[model samples]
Target: MSLVIGLTGGIASGKSTVVELLKKKNAVVVDADWIARQVVEPGTFAYKRIVREFGTQVVGADRKLDRTQLGRLIFGDESKRRQLNRITHPWIIFYMIRDCVMSVLMGRPFIVLDVPLLFETRRLLWLCTVTVVVVCDRDQQIDRLVRRNHLSREEALQRIDSQMPLQEKAAMAHFVLDNSGSLLALEEQVENLWQQLQCIRKQRLRYYKLFGTICFGILVGIPLCRSIATHL
Candidate 1:
């Protein structure tokens, strides 16, 4: 059986970095962001839905959904963000599940689903055998978002604040990849997890077999004992 590993974290929490490391292992990496974008490509149902709701302002001269335009409008507005989520989240989840199932059915030992918003919508959690949450210090997350995305500190914080806290996410994760340190250190941790995961799976299978054997022994022994006692 294949293992589906759901990878998630807040924006700029080094989730992408962790995904890069995972891909180095040759695991099938299904990035939800990419799937989301795919579902919104010009002729997609999601694209049609978004355009119908948001109108032409959100579309460019190329007649495509101007993602940056929509981002500017919705990133700071709660109602708008939720509206956009309503329009696109369902389709995105559909593509994510499709790709994940395809990867697993192809006989890959593991599939890494790099879903940045795994917890945000709570749609794909059921597909995961194990969920790995990549995290960094809150300060680092804020700083990276502000610098990389060119958002103000307030904007960065609001984006971060809109989701589950990193502390809470860590506790809830089946595995946590701390990305506050150097790339080498982060990779070391991932490698360790990979090895330990293999060992844990092996142990689980062995335990299952052992349990089956013990149950069978007891089942047979009980009947034998009863028969011998009756004969005596």
Candidate 2:
């Protein structure tokens, strides 16, 4: 059976970096951000829903989502953000599930679901047997977000504040990755986690086979010994 691992992190915590490295290792990486964008393409239900709810002004002349404009709108208000999430999440999860099944069908031994809001939804537990959370200090996260997204410190902090905190999510994660250090350190942690997971998958199979074989031998041996005792 294929292993489905959920990967999550707070904004700018190096979760994307981990995903990129995992791709280099040929692991199936299913990203939620990409799926969210896909489901909202010009003609999609999600697209129509947003245009209807927020108005046609959010759509660009190119017939696509005005992502920057929408981002500016939703990020400025909690209610608008919720509205956006409500419209996008159903379609995102729909394609996520379908794509996961397709990955299994395609013989992907392991599939990683990259979700930024994995902890908030709590639906990941239904499908993911294992969860890995990437984390960093609040200061580091704020710094990275500002640098990567070209936002002011306060804007970056506002974005981070919008999601579930790293501490809360990490508390329940099967594995926690610390990315507050240098690139090499982060890479080493990811590599170590990958190796540990591989070992666990193999050992779990070995344990099942070993226990089954032992149980079978005991059943057969006990019956034969009982028969011999009766004859004697």
Candidate 3:
């Protein structure tokens, strides 16, 4: 069985850097953001549902989702945001699980599920053998968002505030990758994490094999022991 690692972080907290390092280590990385975009593509069930619920106003002239428009609508309104999550989160979870299962069946040693909302979703956390959260100071996160996403300070703060706080997520994680310092420091953390995950995967596989062998021995010994008693 493959070990499933749930990777998550607050927006702009350097989760992508950890993901890149995991990829370099040949981990099967299933990105939830990529799945989110694919599931909402034109002609998808999510696309149809979104259009029906939010109307064509959220659809562009090209008949595709106007993500910016949808974002504007949902950002301030909790009800609309919940409605959108209701439509898409299920499909996202379905695809994420399917991909992870496929990886496991293919005999992948481990998989990294890069989900932005892994902790917030609750159910996704149960799927992981280990949960890793990338963390940075709130000011650092806000600055990174402003620089990377080009959002205004207020907008960046709003986006950050929408999710579970970084401290809370870090508390819940089995492993925390701190990105508060240099890239080299972050890379070192990832290297150590990769080594730990490899060790964990091996240990889990060893335990499973031992357990299976014991069960098989018990099954075979039970019949032989009964036969010997009968002969006696």
Candidate 3 structure quality by residue, lDDT tens digits, 13-85: 9999999989888899999999999999999999999999999999999998998788778876788988999
lDDT of candidate model 2 versus the reference: 0.88
Question: Could you give the candidate ranking by TM-score, starting with the highest?
Answer: 3, 2, 1
- Whole-model lDDT, model 3: 0.92
**Which runs of model 2 end up more than 4 angstroms from their true locations?**
207-232
lDDT of 1 by residue, 1-232 (tens): 5778888888899988888887888778988888888888898887988888888899999988888788777877889889988888888888888888887788787788888778766788899888899889889999999999898898888788877887777787899989899999998999998997677667767887999999999999999999999999
Clashes of each: 0, 0, 0
TM-score (all chains, Cα) for each model:
0.85, 0.86, 0.96
- RMSD after CA superposition, every candidate: 3.9, 3.9, 1.3
Estimate the overall C-alpha local distance difference test score of candidate 1. 0.85
Best-to-worst lDDT order: 3, 2, 1
Q: Tens digit of lDDT per residue, candidate 2, span 65-102?
A: 99877877888799999999998988888888888989
Off by over 4 Å in 3: none
- Higher-ranked by lDDT: 1 or 2: 2
**Highest TM-score scorer:** 3
